[model samples]
Structures are given as structure tokens and as C-alpha cells.
Target: MLHGGSLPHLTPEETLAPILSALESVLGSARPVALHQPHFAGREWDYVKDCLDTGWVSSVGAYVTRLETALQDYTGVAHALAVVNGTAALHVCCLLAGVIAGDEVLLPTLTFVATANAVSYCGATPHLVDVSPVTLGVDAIRLAAYLEDIAELRGDTCYNRTTGHPLRALIVMHTFGHPAELDALAELCRRYRIVLIEDAAEALGSFYRDQHVGQWGLLSAVSFNGNKIVTTGGGGAVLTNDAALAQRARHLTTTAKQPHPWAFVHDQVAYNYRLPNLNAALGCAQLEQLPDFVSRKRALAQRYQHAFAAVAAGHIVNEPQDTRSNYWLNVLQLHPAYGHLRDALLETCQARGILVRPAWELMHRLPMYRDCPRMDMSTAEHLERHLVCLPSSVDTGSVDTGSEHA
Candidate 1:
């Protein structure tokens, strides 16, 4: 895949036609340059074999503890709870955050729909806010403004003009592995009596102002999906400094049962969202290589940046400098002047055996969230129109674009 800004000169139609033609002609060259892929060096196989041999491939095992320990060390959280997936991690976080039915959770419209979906799963409404052009995370100032507006209107009888629910927490995402302006957002949440939760799913190794991203919020989540920097195939973790919250998450994630295996007494309608030992085995091995993966990913991003500069003028894109990103997905925004070129670029990349993608359609615009209240979605709309994501797999060596395409 090419750098964020560099593209070969071609009109939109010219770019798109090749892709459509190749869709029929180049049957084997349609692989996407994904932002991430699972990384293993036979270690995963060894772990899987070990799990099968030991007959402990389900929920309970040493690997589960090891995975959590590794994450606690990596993220600097006092405790971490392993769960079935990132969405489950977020659901557990919302429960621990005291988010009840009818409560409102503030979220950015630019994030993955799952962030909002998790809130809805708890029966809490999501108040979608616009993202900052710079960080692509929730804009702290805008969030503070929303809180003030809610307070000024006063009482449970009042409704936010932006969203009708009572704003209770702010869920800030470190989008595409870039850290958000979390410090300011944290202070705002504290002042507003709103809970702060970090969706650090895309930013496992990312730092903000020299500190890790997951530790800033009251509770945070990390995803180990097949597409993340590191993968457990499908797993996630919940982080917290509070002991009680960590314990609660652990109990809830393991099915919220009262201890006797034969009794099967459940105090709450708990979900079966535990991360199995087999997945934990993969997570354990992946955790061992995170530092290497992050370093290589960064180097790959740098190579793309430099190559794009030489490949074409005004074509290379780079992440802003204020926050250090894991470089999960290198993004480029087409010039608004070239706004019509976005669709063409995607097609061109596909034709050339590179998989490229446009930014997600705004969550608020999707069918499920169309009725949700959103405030000033101009930024989201602008991004949606111009943004594109190139292939960014950890397994693909930066200079080896041919191998990546293969």
C-alpha cells in the first residue's frame, strides 16, 4: 500500500474502471492492505497444541492469568479483566460505571458503531458528538460545552437539545491507534460528575503526553481482535485502578454465578462473555511480541511517509504530532478540492491489488443510529467524504509492498 497522501495521477472514473475490470480479471489480486493482522511465529501453534494436550482449552487455565498479567504490565492498570471481545469489555465497563437504563453516554460520531452499540446494550442512550479535525477523538471543548448546556437547562425534566438523554458518562475513543486529548476530557468528566471510559481498542501501545492511553479513564477497554496490532483471534480486556471495579468485572465476565458448580445460582442475568483458555493462549504469546510489533509498525509508517514524499507531491499523509499513535491504520484525507477523487482512489488501489477503504459512514447516519441525536456533525461529514485507510498489516514488511499485496 502507498503512503497516506501519495496516489498515481488518474481521474475518478479512470481509477474506478480499472478496479471494476480487475474484479473480474484479476481474481487473486483483491487482497486488502489491512490496518493490522495477527502476528505469530509458530509460537501460537505451540500454545494451541499445549492447550489441546492439557485438556484445559476452555475458560480456566494459566494462560488466561498470564494474558491479564501481561496486559496489566503493558497498560499500567492496577488490574485487568479478560472478556470475550472488545464489545463485551465495553458492556462490562458500562455496568461497572453505574450506567443504568435511561442514562446518557456521550460519544463521538466518528468512532466504530460498536462504541455506541455497547452503551445501547446497557439500555443507556448515546449522545453523539462531533470529533476534532486534529485528534479525531471527541473534542474536549465541545464535550464540556454539551455538559454546560445540560446543567444550565437543569433538572431531570430537561433534555439536551443535542440528545434527549441525561448525559452521565463520556466514552472517548483513541481512534485508529491515535491517542485522544484524554487529559482534558478526563478533567471535564470529573467536573461534570460524568464517568469517563476509554475505548483504547485500537491503541494498545499508544501514549498521550508520555502516559499510556488506557490508564487515563476510570475504566478502559482494549481489543485483541484478528485485526488489532496484537490478536487473540477474538478477545478483549477491561482496565481499572479500582479493586472493586476490577473484581466486579471479573465476576460478571465469568457469568456472574455464585461459586458452586453444581448449584448454578445466578444473582443477575449475566452474559457468557468469558475469554476461553485457548484464546488466552494466543493472547499470551501475542503479548510477548507487542513491543516488537509496535516498533516495526512505526518503522513501516515512517517508510510510507518518506516514500510517499518521493512518489508524488501532495499525496502523502501523516498523523498529527501531538499524540503518539500505534500507527494502527495510516490515514490520508483527500483535499476537499479533490473530494470527488476519494471514490476513485479506493477503486484504483483495489485494481492495483491493494485494498483501501473510505472512512466509515457516520454512525448517526447508519440505519440503527439514524434516530439518535447528534450535534453539529459537520466534522464527521467532512471526514467521511475525504478520508481513506490504506493497508497496514504488521506482518507485511514496509518496503515489501509486493509481498503485502500477494
Candidate 2:
């Protein structure tokens, strides 16, 4: 629908013209291109069928253990616990990081709401921070400066000068599978005496400086949602290098049941967040093909970069230096001068079945988090206005619409 036809009731601005043309060139004019979709070209059917045939579709099964082991190996984390969803994994991470009531957790304002919600679940305040334009994640330098000004380091704990709440942890979310500046952020956290946690929900195949993204944090969360590069039909995983933390995560996520074969012995109150065998069966198959999926996704991102190279209004957001990204969802960041055209572009693209979308609203802007402690949000606000996510499914057939670049 967005191929060569003119948009009705539109001013036909030069900026919008090239963007639409690029979308048409990459995604064709026949059908809608979803922003992100799961591709199950691996052994999903075989593994899932095996689970079905064996009647091990519940939480306790061989597939669940296999999936966890595979994740541990893939991410290079000593422990990987498969959970019900990404949010659940984050919640567990927050708990493990010792985020208690009245504590404050540093979070990127540009991330999804789930990151903030997870902290809230731990009874901690989500102290919002700004993100870097280069990585679209927490700006380590800016945050360091902000912390130097407002953070009080007494003993080994970091406290907010204004709120007087202990800064328990810093959650760095890898936006669109692009790894954040983990080394710098880790150094900053160490100086401030704050824990480092990673919201790696979108960074399954991403690596920072040859090291996987989740390895830098004390604990990290990864998602396998339907729209993610890897999907477990709504599942997630918690990764940690500490064996003690891993053991606690396993017990907590499994309802804290002490090992007893014949008796229903229960320990402390915990959650039933274990991943079902049905979901892990799918996850195992998906994990096996992660390398292929990341390759195809990177290829798709290259295509988008080439298609939009000549567009003066914006350019595709590339992976940061020294990082290998999965390019989970390719981003088109409009130039500051062309920021006003973002809405028009989104509306036009969606109307024409291109399925483009803007980034999520900043966490500080949301009503529930309006009163949360926050620093200057100028960077995130600008990014929110200029960012647009393009269709980035791994299936290249849907995007190979011919070389009709604008």
C-alpha cells in the first residue's frame, strides 16, 4: 500500500516521501510488515511434539531443565532459570539485589514500563535516569555526573541526597538488542556502591566488547516473547554467574518448596513463576537456532541501513562501537530538525500498512511514575520524539521487496 502511490490529504513533505519509499523498497507493497515477529523455522515442532507425546507439558519436565542448561551455555552465565515472563525474571532480580521497600533503583526512562513495574513489585521506587543517544540505554557518563551531585555515599551504601532513600541497584536495559556501555556503567556502580542489574529483555544474542550483555550484571533478565527474536510462547529467563543466587532463584521461582518426595513441604512465601514444559520445549528449539536468527536479523538491519542511507531526514540506529547487536528492532532516528515529522511519518506508515511505531513513552511521563525521583530527562524526551521502530522480523522473505530505494 505504500509503494508508489501518493498519500491522500498529506502535504507530501520531502522527509516523509523518502521514508515511505524506503519502507516500500524493503517491505514491498503487498502485505503489512509487523514491527517484530517470531520465526519458528527450527525444531520447534519436534520438541513441542515430544513434550506433548510424553505428557510433560507442566512446569516440571525435562524440557524445562534442558532449556535452562542451554541458556546457561549460550549466555555464558553459570545459572539460568527459565521463568514465566521477562517481568517475572526482573522481579526476581530486584529481590536478589536486595531492593527493599523505600529503596530506590536507577532505571532508564527510555525503557519499557515492565522495567519500572518490576522494581515496584519489589516495593522499591523506580528512580528514572536518562539514556545515551548512541546506545539508547542508560547514559553512564551523565548518570555518573548526576550521582556525584546528588548521591551520598555513607559507609558502603549509596543514598539519594534528595529522597534519603538507599540507591540499591542500577538496571541497564539494552534497547532494541543493542548492548549498553556496561564497563563504564559497572565502574560507575562500583564507585557509588550500588548493585548492577541488567534488563536484557531484548538482548538475547547481543554482546558487549566480546562478552555477552548479561554477564556484566550481578543478575539479568531475558525475554522470549512472541515479538522477540526468540519466542517461547510467553516465557523468560534469569541469568546469574553466582551459584548461590541461582539456587535461591530456582527455589523462589518454584514456590520455595523444600525437597521432599512424599510430603507437600513448603518453605518461605515465594512465587509460582516456573516456565511450563510446553514453553521450554519451544524455547529449547528456539535457543538452538539463535545464532541463525541473530545473523538474519543483522542482515535485515544492514538492508534497512542501505535503504535509508540517502534519506536526509533520518538514519537507522546502528549498534554501538565494539558491540555485536542482534538488531532486534531496527530504529530510525529522525534528525532534530525533522523531529516534528515523527507523528506524520508514523501515521502515514501505519495507514499504508507499514506498521511502524514510536518508542514507548518515557517512564517519568507515565502517571504512576510521575512522582518518582528523576534527573534531567531532556535526552530521553528528544529520543522519544525522534525514534521510530521499523519492521524487523528475521524472515527476510517478507522484507525483500526489491531494490526500489528512495
Candidate 3:
């Protein structure tokens, strides 16, 4: 069994061989193991069929409300408003957090582009920041230091000293379903008087210090995309503890219409971002199996961890201390010395029908965000180069945690 200690002396291809074998051992020689796939073994068909049979398949139906209530109960939030998709949910969260035009929102550069895009939707600039290797989310400590040096408080608003734009919100994304350090980040938000918004798109089942990930933020968003742990085919929700904010979220997402039997009266300019009842039905079913899905995925991660334990080239990225991750995507981060082999390893793994991928390109590197203001991206850059997302579908084979290796 090849191990990390021996990796430095081996060629790129040699180093990749053990990693590939480890993945194959755990996932079997299943010709096309997807990175992550939705598992619908619950009441999916039954509920969806109910929607179809009743001809109540659009946005305004019982299923939508049912799913919202389910999410609120599961996540322990006071309210959850279903929307068209995660992006829409995030946009609404931004709006609810008071992120207006010309404002600057702080978010990690390592997050999915949607996090940055949501800020842009509010006509706000995404001020990219680095992430912590521990959480694969925002580095709250570094951010506090950076903010202290570059931000100044004017009354209750935090403004970028250089750009002169108000720092209205800080988005903390739970990368790959691992909860970020919410307590620290929340404190930073308080000291700076900036609103905290959680991009919990991949963290539906994740928890931080016994509480759900979305609870720390004033307003947060959860995704139910086809690839997520809980799938609505295509849907999302805005979560909040404040009843007033929840009421406003519902109004804004539903096009800001005043309740009337026949009058078509809209009070403000809002979005038609309602999640269809059909999708909500599916979501309700998926939410029912979230616990099982999270369990299976976590077991799969443990298998990968043990399999790669002897592989000195790299190791699995586990949940940070005191946090419970959904393990939405199992990650294998190559040792810094072997970072150059990352592309080769990805190519080899894909060639063998074992699907794997690298992390998202840092947000600031994108063409549209090329000129966006950013802090040091050294950590994110390093993570982007070395992180490989392994097969993490709920149906993947699991191994006993007590075993030495898969």
C-alpha cells in the first residue's frame, strides 16, 4: 500500500496510482460513478403523483406550504420560504439583509459562483476573501484582521476604506456541506455591524455546535438542486428566525402582492421566484430521507478516509471540530508538495470511470469578477489546486468505520 511519506520521490503517474486504486476499492469498478447523485427512495413518487392527480402542480398549492413547514421543523428555524432555486433564495436573502445597489458584500473566493452572483443580483460588489483550510469556508480570524485594517465604521455601517462602498453583508458559505465557523463569523459581523447571510446551499443537514448552519445568519438560503442531499429537482428556501423578515421574504419572493380575492394589486417590485408545488412535493419527500442520506454519505466519507489513510500523498478533508457535515462532497486534498499532480490525478481517475473533480475556480478569477476587490487569495488558491471532490452519492458503498481500510 503506497503512503504519503513515499509520495515525494515518485513521479506524478506513480503518485496517482495509489489514489486511483483507493477510490476503486471503495467505489468498486463501477464504470461511471457520479460525483454526487440524488437518491429518491422515499415518498417522492407518491407525493408528486398526488400533485399531478389534483392538478395543483404550480406554485400556489398545499405541497409548497407543507414543504416550508417541514424545512422549518427540520432546521429549527422559525420560517422557511420556498423559492424557484438556490440562487433566487440567495438573492432574496441579500435583499432581506439590506444589500442594495453599489454596496460591497464580503464572501469567500473559494465558494460556488452562485454565492458571488447573488450579491451581484442585488447590484452589489462581491469583495472576495480567503477561506480557512479547517472549515473550507470563510477564515473568520483572517477576515477580522483584514476588516480592521481596511474597514471603518460610520455610525452602524461598515465601509471599505479604499472602495468607499458600504460593506452591507458577509456571506458565509458552508463549503461542500461542512459548516463554517459560524460563531466566530457571527461575532465578526456584530463587531463590524454587517449583516450575516449564510450561503448554506450545500449544507441542509449540516450543524455547527448542535445548531443548524442557517441559524446563525440573520437570513440564509438552502438549495434543493438535483445534485444536493435533498432534491426538489430545482428549488431552494430562505430561512430566518425573525417573523417579520420571514413575512417580508414570503412577500418579496411571491411578487409582493397584497392578499385579495380578485384584485391584481402588487405593492412593490418583487420576484416571481416561487417554487412550484410539484417541486415542493419532491422536496418534502427528499427532506424525509435527509437523515438517512446524510448518514450514508458520512459513512462513505469515512471509508474514503480509511482507504486513503496510508496514502501519504494526501488525505480526506474531514468535518471541522464540533461540526457535523453532510459530507455533500468528499474531498481529498493533495499534500502541498504534490499539488502539481492534481490535474493528472483527476484525468486518470476520470479515465478509469471514477468521477472526480477539482474545486471551483476562485471567484475573482472569473472574467466578470476580474476587477472585483479582494483580500489575499493565497489559501484559496492553494486549496483550489489540491482539492479533489470524490464520488459522494448517497447510494455509494459504505465500509465499517472500525475497519483499517476499505
Each prediction's Cα lDDT score? Answer: 0.77, 0.90, 0.91
**Which ten residues in a row are the worst by lDDT in model 2?**
397-406
CA deviation > 4 Å runs, candidate 3:
1-8, 398-406
Candidate 1, residues 158-243, lDDT tens digits: the string is 34555455677789998888888888998987666678999999999898877788887889999989888888889999999999
lDDT of 2 by residue, 1-406 (tens): 3222343443547669988888788876666667776777778889999999999999999999999999988888889999999999999999999999999999999999999999999889999999998999999999989998999999999999998999999999999999999999999999999999999999999999898889989999999989888899999999999999999999999999999897778789899999999999999998999998899889889989999887767889999999999999999998776788999999998888778899999999999999999999999999999999999888744534321112
* Candidate 2: residue 193 lDDT (0-100): 93
Sorting all predicted structures by TM-score, with the top scorer first, yields: 3, 2, 1
- What's every prediction's RMSD, in angstroms? 4.8, 4.9, 3.7
Highest TM-score scorer = 3
The TM-score values for the models, in the order shown, are 0.88, 0.95, 0.96
In candidate 1, the residue pairs with backbone N, CA or C atoms under 3 Å apart (3 or more residues apart, or in different chains) clash, namely: 5-315, 5-316, 5-317, 6-315, 6-316, 33-391, 34-392
- Off-target runs (Cα >4 Å) in candidate 2 are 1-12, 396-406
lDDT of 3 by residue, 238-336 (tens): 999999999999999888999999998999999999999999999998899888888988888899999998887889999999999999999999988
For candidate 1, the TM-score is 0.88
Candidate 3 Cα deviation (angstroms), residue 294: 0.9
